[model samples]
Target: MRDRFLTGLIGYPIAHSAAPAMHEQAATALDAHCHYQLIEVAGAGRDDLRAMLEGVRRLGFAGVNVTFPYKEAVVDLLDELTPDARAIGAVNTIVVDGTRLVGHNTDATGFARAIAPLLATKSRGAIALIGAGGVGKAIAFALAGLGAGEIRIFDADAAKATELADQLQGGVAARSVATAVDGAAGLINATPVGMLPNRDTPVPDTLLHPAMWVADAVYSPLWTPLLSAANAKGATVLTGRDLAINAAADAFALFTGMTPPVAVMGNAFDAVMAARYSPSA
Candidate 1:
């Protein structure tokens, strides 16, 4: 039996990624030998992506997770994609099967899994989803799968939001909005705003209400400004940590064919967060 498996993540500005520790620790708990690496290809172009994909396979990597600026682009280079990934038009995880590379999007399922506990007994309603980028698209689909009745999308790039809404027409009543929809049942932030080094919230504080449920995709700090404001307003909140850990768990399963130790992965994630955000170096 092979004693070791190797995995990695490909992205620009991945210095803050918690995936490596989470997957590595999960592998340890499962009595498996695995090494997870960070392959930061900052400012990579089309030719660079192709080379990176070819290089990882040639180097015997089991798989790799793709992030920002590359998730959508990686799809064309892959031999196949999981159905959900195809529908979401993005690929965050890729598996290398010998010479064949397959793509999969765990973001949608991961977001769904993370929020399942919150919505188990609650009624589904209209969602105000901010951002229509890759992550936004994934969450929008996840919301549709959750049986959401309607979704209002707001993106700085109006055409992108319109395109996403048009694509989601059959699944959910999606519409591109000029601004955050007032009085929506839930508010989700899928953009990079409120992430580390950027303290801006996707929407203004006045838009938040106690009646709404709030979720953010920025998990590095765990307690983002948007989530904090939502919490102050007495809204039920889901931080980026919830999304990140769950997504990491799903990707780990894809890379290793094993059910990840969620508790272990969560702890590993917390450790990384602490080191990254601690007051003292």
Candidate 2:
């Protein structure tokens, strides 16, 4: 008999997340009666999130994915945290069992795995990362684990950038977009600057050279301005979709203990993208 269960994603302003469709499709392909939904917890604080956690377990949900402001805020509310999430000080995936809530940071591993194969022979080079938010921290730590030589973080909140740098025990150079891109072999955008409504780029196009490898964590628009500019400059580009695929793959393993059918998941994501953005779909 197939296992019947429930799983969902929890976040504020999560109408744009692809988690429900991706997870539901994966469960269907596996012949498992699993349902995934999106739970938007508005004005969600610790107590509010705890209520949702309790509700999911009571309702027999297998797990739930956490996103945005809650990634760090939910840490203290978790019953247990995986070492990786602990190391990065953030949690994007949470599994609830009875009274215990286990938190995991799959973004770090996911981004690393997604971009590893695409990186040039000089994978072990200095990288400049913009934005130091939840995802930014995960990506920074992921790059460090992937053997990146140096990571320089820049954020409007310099203290946040400095804090992330301190966690890496590496050089924390505070420089503007122009100065930060100097001699950097890789550039990563972990901020929301290039998302749908905000098409403006955090870094100048002039700073982007043909030699650098660029990756953006925002997947909403798919063709973010940052990625567009990087691509125009002939830099090897990694899209937000790439990160989504890898992160969803990791989440599949976490939510259901099986290797994900990546092809099916990819197709589903592409279909969703097409439906949302295609002019004549």
Candidate 3:
């Protein structure tokens, strides 16, 4: 039997990732022997990805999380994909069972859990979503699952938004808009505009109003400019921390084969956030 459960993350520029801390904390809370490592594959090609996956499997890693450019690229290399991963066209978590590598996506589940607390009020009307990439696709499907009435998607690459809209046409009353529409019940920023080192807002401040709810997927700073503006205007806001923490908890469960202590994982993430975003830091 394996004494230590080994897992890792495969991504470029992952030196600042908080996943290791969260998973390690979860391991302790569950009284398990787990070691989560980071395997940086910066600028890796398909052949490189194949090699890394092979090496990790041979090394007996339970699983690994994929991020950024490799999420979609790693799908074809997996032996099988979960239904959510297949529909979202991305895989964020890969589980190695014996010789079979199964791909799963926790982003959708995480996003759904993140927005759940607000759905009671936000699900009544239309939702304006920015960006239509991997995370965007997952959130779009999550919104449908949450019973959002209508979804308006906008991307700088107009075709991307249109394509996502077409995918959700029959399921949800979704359409592509040229820009952020006014008077929507909720607005979401799924782009990386407000991420660390970048303070730009994806949608203009004028598009935000006190009557709407706002959610940003960028959590490094926690209080993104978009969320800050929404807060100042009296709009209800949801930060990226909830999404990040919940997703990490779900991935930890997949890696260790144990029920995750979500509260402990959340507290661990809070500690990471405070340390990273503190004024003294």
Candidate 4:
């Protein structure tokens, strides 16, 4: 028997999340009555969190996608953590089976899958990753797992970047801004610098080159200044929307326990982009 009425995403400031649209389209395609909603938990304290979990239990939601500040914070609240999530120290997807909430980290795997085809024919080279926060750490580990020749990290919080580097041991090198992009085959920005209302690129456009591949973890604007600069430089650009779609694919699988129709998910994502930037409905 097919499960009825499942899945949702939890986070603060979730008004912009594409999860509901993506999953709704998927559920529709699968002929499943599942519904996905955005549960805004901003300013929700510990008691509020408990109440929310209890409500999920009472409502029998199949799973929920967790994001941003709550990814780490929700770990302690979960009944169990998958090995991958435990290693990454973050969880972006959670499955509620019986009375147990199992946390899993799909961001790393999702990113690897999305970037693999792009790199399949190209030679692996050094990567300069900016931002050393949770998502940054996950991406760093994913890149290392992919066996990139070298990884360099830079962050305004030098110590935090260094800490991530140390965790990666010899796989990463901590570098200064001037030499950060030097000879790097790829550049990744995991910071919020280019997010909505903040149109600045974390790295200078002067540093971009045709030989480099640029990726930013900020997807809201879809066309971040960094991506624009990379494209102008003739570099291959990977936008955050790509990552979001890929991550949502993984989350969809976790929530439904079935392979998501990538084409359907892609269409839904494009629809979201259209609605978001469309001048008229």
Best by lDDT: 1
C-alpha displacement of 76 in model 4, angstroms?
2.4
Q: Against the true structure, what is each candidate's TM-score? A: 0.94, 0.93, 0.93, 0.91
Clashes of 4: 0
TM-score of 4: 0.91
- Higher-TM-score candidate of 1 and 2: 1
The per-residue C-alpha lDDT of model 4 at residue 131 equals 84
lDDT of each: 0.85, 0.82, 0.84, 0.82
TM-score of 1: 0.94
State the lDDT of candidate 2 residue by residue for 1-281, as single tens digits.
Answer: 32665888888677777777787788789887668888987788778987888887678777888887678888888889999999999999888656678999989988998877866465566688998888989998888887777788888898888888889886545556666678998888988787766789988898999988888898888888988999999998888887887788788787778778887788888888888878985
Task: Give me the displacement of residue 275 in model 4, in angstroms.
Answer: 1.7
- Using TM-score as the measure, the top candidate is 1
Better-scoring candidate (lDDT), 1 or 3: 1
Off by over 4 Å in 2: 120-123, 171-175
Model 4 / residue 63 / CA error / Å: 1.2
Candidate 3 or 4, higher lDDT?
3
lDDT of 3 by residue, 24-83 (tens): 878887777778899987899999999989977788899999877688788899899998
Clash counts per candidate, in order, are 0, 0, 0, 0
For model 3, the superposed segments whose C-alpha errors exceed 4 Å read 1-3, 171-179
